[model samples]
Target: MPQRSSTFNPHDPVTLQRMQSARSIHSEIMGCQLRKKKVLELLPPFGAGKDYPPQPPDIETYIVEFDGADDPMHPQNWTVRKKLRVMTVLGFATFVVAWGSSIFSPAIFVISEVFHISTVTAILAISLYVLGFASGPLVWGPLSELYGRRPPTLISTFTSAVFHMGVARSDDLASIMICRFFAGFFGASCLAVVPASFADIFGNKTRGMAIAIFATCVFIGPLIAPVVGGFIVTSYLGWRWTAYLTSIMGFSSFALVVYFMDETYPPQVLVEKAQFLRRETDNWCILARQEQSKFELSDLLEHNISRPLKMLFTEPILFLITLYTAFIYGILYLLLEAYPIIFYEGYGMAFQISELPYLGVVVGQIFGGAMVVAFEPMTYKRIVANGGRPIPEIRLIPTMIGSMLFTIGMFWLTWSGAYHRHVHWIVPTISGIFTGMGLISIFLSALNYIVESYLMFAASAVAANTFLRSGFGAGFPLFAGAMFKNLGVQWAGTLIGCIALILVPVPVLFYLYGKRLRTMSNYAPT
Candidate 1:
């Protein structure tokens, strides 16, 4: 075997970054190693493929290529079925976290009455929990980079289950608020880590579908919560069961994660491999990133925290899409505020029966999943036909149509509410479905685009999306009731719809200018 030597400076983020970049070279060279067993192999040239355009030019200097591109330890070399199984476990973990966020929304009044707080303040249980969702990612995203994704994910998720149990048992307002926030904070791991895991496992060709499936599962969690939460509220068990049952579900998610998930982050896997090889062959030259870089907490924190923000500001494509996604996310959470008003206040339905309206959003999520199934392949085919280089803009095509549908659905709900007696309840309920589809379409597009554009930095880009959107998710509901109460349902919805309509230009601008935008950034592909 041939050996090479270079000065090792552990703790350099640039060197750490190059360690990650080496995996692509390793993956690209997979099968070629068989023919070159006795020769020095050149690094794999990147770009003009569904994989990212390539890491920074310097990454090739610090690392060894894998034995071949098909090396089984490399996640990209995993079978499709194995890749998806990891996604499934991660997706299920996500479902319970989101379920905890929204399931208790319908019971806010009950919680208020029990705790003797105002209904407005009671709504903070939901919003504060979402605030935790936003903030947790800021911490967890960096933690995952320091540790691998799995430890932080498992630890956070398991503790989130404990917090949910605390939420169930809380007798005072402060207790519930504190417990819910912690629960959201811990529960955020699945959201923060899993998409990055997806990117780690799949190449660009299939990442869209992976995100779509995980996102579909995520969308379903909140929408379906009202169905079960409503029954718990109306039943003798009362509102606390919403948290109690969700806590139990969180525990179940914990077990699924511990049993099924193995480390998928490529750099971590390589570190383990390097360790094993060193012990086996007594070859200290088998270097992985962890061995090459000294761990520096302050540098890690600064780089992880500031780099995403830096990329966020400099990259116009990321800014536009993330802002759009943040609004769409906020609106989705805002619906938790809107739905009970429409059904309970407007139609005078019982709590359990009123939840039937949320089924509309569930139906819309399904339709959105189907749209991805239908349209994603078309998008993929176009990328393939373009000689394998995927344009980040391809993600925006569905988003354009989604923006229009979202606007129409918002208007439909607004106008239909004024004539509820003249029109069947089904009319406005279907509006939820259309709006749900619009929401999901925009979500999937933006998420896939972020994954495509940022590539390795996806966790950070997504964290930025989560921060702004989750803030909106948290803040919007604080005012949701006020808007509907003061303006009435029709005009309040019009207020929202008009904003969405104005932002409709977001996708159009990106689609036309994405390439030009990428040109301005060192991060985005040309």
Candidate 2:
């Protein structure tokens, strides 16, 4: 019957009307199916009902997405210069927050003298700031996912600057502690969100180098802080200037972000585009798929707040990597205490001079970053060979190498500093290079691995990692003095080294079995 109709004239009114009506219906059905597919793509695979409620069938929905693979509005398609501008702002924000964590560390003694508190109690200035890091991520990570990177960054950074101002203006220890903790609470937004931002702008081919640069900033900030803080504390500017300077930097970061940073998260970008489209077309039905989902407080608590902790416990890869990185992070902070003991007390160096040794670690971090950058071509080759799919385990190779270097550095510093009276101060300081390289390598690898493995859920994974690592960082300094004094530099360092040695197999095991683990994971891409 259709074949018979094909011979009919095109100009026949009934035939033309019927054909146009059929085409219209077919177009509407296809459009509906396409929108449905996109909505499904946006919804969380598990518990989609709880997270994103189903839209009523009576409503016609228009889902907005990138124009195509080459959409200029997409972060992935942004010019290199634009991405770097955003990254520069984010990286500086990360550095400022990390620098804030330890800048006050050099002022502990001054704080103790002013407040008539023990050095141990004064250490709370740093500890509380780091502890704030742990709590801040729980809020910032979810908010970033909900609202996008820019809002949380601006709000938190500005608030953090105000709190830093409060710390600068405080007259009492209680006020200072409160201000410091809140500053960190806000500042931790950078730590929790920046890595995810990096993942957004950089693809798999170049992400390792980008993350290496990020990890270098993270590891080097505290190291650099003691150096800068030592100068600030020892100078006529005094300890308050430490807070003042950090505040200035924080404010600067806020300004840069406000002026330079564009929203990078794809879903949030689509939401903005959808809003613009709705305005132009006067069609309220047009919406980003993410906008269709109602944001419930209960859903936020269940998915955003609790999910990271739940993943920490349930995911072997996340838990082990978090544990491994946390321990290294703790030792890094512990060195804030241990370095002074080793160099200042043992070798009779001045406080500021003792802080100079941290530069060795800084140099090592540079080397570690170079190492990661150098490996990028090889990784790209492997990715091409594997038909464009990246292997998460390949990221762990540097981690394995870093683990051994970490252990080696620990023992080297332990023995050299144990004989501080006999050994040249340079001996122990030289160990910092190895420690720094190892630290950067391990941290960079872990971060990239998690991002690659988890894909969309990277922010939550990083928040979990940050939570544990900050806990260790905050706790380690409190016991560092006692441990170094009681166990002696040699034994205490040996203890840390042995633990590091135990964790050395983590990357290796993951490298071998990561695919299997990822295949079984509920959240990670298989």
Candidate 3:
């Protein structure tokens, strides 16, 4: 009855309040609808099949996404200065983790003497640390996907630093082994996640150059570590200083990361934005597509935990690439032991001086990276010519070349250093340049190819690669002493070189058939 009075109610507080509330509710509902529309338009279609179970029909949902292509929040749209700062911090983090892997090499003798363990047992410190690398990526990879790059990187690196400190203070072999393994496990985060972060920020055209820089940091870390660790071990500061030094570097990296790093993962960013919008609007329906599904332990296990393993086994591109990278990584670690045999013992060089040869490998890595960077413009032109879509095979060119160089270096180092001891020491040491160049070239190319091929799944693909390579890395050094000692450096080196030669065609095969394989893959972009 009162509704019949449609006029003369301007001064009535009750009527005005009711009318204002109605308008406010209508505005909120319209706003949500418009937002949902914008989100759908901006987002790529989820395709026919749904990844998550359907939401209840009765509930209205508003998805949150980047505003548009120019959305500054997008990682790709971040300012070059900020991206470079982030890259530098990440590069350092990666370098520190890698450095930690081999720093213990120089301390092996000291550890053997102090702990009254065999040289082989003393080597466990390095082996276990690398083994940790194998396992850490399994968890870190999934966590990076579920959370974001920054959190996993910070947590793992900081924890690794703590473990390094644990190794530093440990008095017993058991304690040392545990600490070293855990340190490596935590340190593996940088290996598993940094490449993905690089991919997140850099577009395909420039990603190769970024990955090349990353590869240099990676390979150079181990190359430089022994030099530093050797001096530290031979000093009054003692072998423990090696672990302490790594811990210091780790902490420094963590500090830098805390100061400079921002979330680069686009999905995670959108999820955070959605959470912020929900808080501001007091609307529970505002959700990121990533947030649409309720968190379940089963989903996490099935999707995040198992996906990399599944992809690793199922995808040929991933498997072969991982295998090749793993072999190269293994050889790199094996050289940690082999170099000492050839230089320190065989060549009768001082322990401190033997470590210097690693610098040759470092130089080679720099050249390799430079080569990849140099090729980026040509690749970019190809990308442009192909209508702005990158062909993953184009990345394999360097790998093909590097494979031959790696094989050559392997033979040169082993034969000259082992068989022709009278040959100048520089002969063997200089060979490191080729090995280093080949190592970095193959590594950089494989990584760029993986990132381009898998796109959104780059993290998992990389994790799979890391898992296999770290396994190789962990195992190689354990056998290096015996293999080089028994097989003689020449035969041992020849064996590895032969393997490298056999694998030479891997990149070539992929380069020729990669497109077809990608088209056939479930994980790779068609």
The reply for model 3, stretches above 4 Å from the true place, is: 1-61, 419-421
RMSD of 1: 10.2
- Writing each residue's lDDT as its tens digit, candidate 2 over 280-362 gives 88877787655655434665676667777888889988998889899989988999999999988999888888899989889
lDDT of 1 at 241: 93
Candidate scoring better on lDDT of 1 and 3: 3
Ranking by TM-score: 2, 3, 1
- lDDT of model 2 at residue 526? 59
- Candidate 1: give the clashing pairs: 10-293, 10-294, 11-293, 11-294, 29-69, 30-68, 30-69, 30-70
User: Candidate 1 versus the native: TM-score?
Assistant: 0.87
Cα lDDT tens digits, model 1, 223-273, are 899888988898999898999999999898889889888888776777778
C-alpha positional error of residue 305 in candidate 2 after TM-score superposition, expressed in Å: 1.9
Give all candidates' CA lDDT scores.
0.79, 0.84, 0.85
The order by descending lDDT is 3, 2, 1
Query: In terms of lDDT, which candidate is stronger, 2 or 3?
Result: 3
Clashing pairs in 3: none
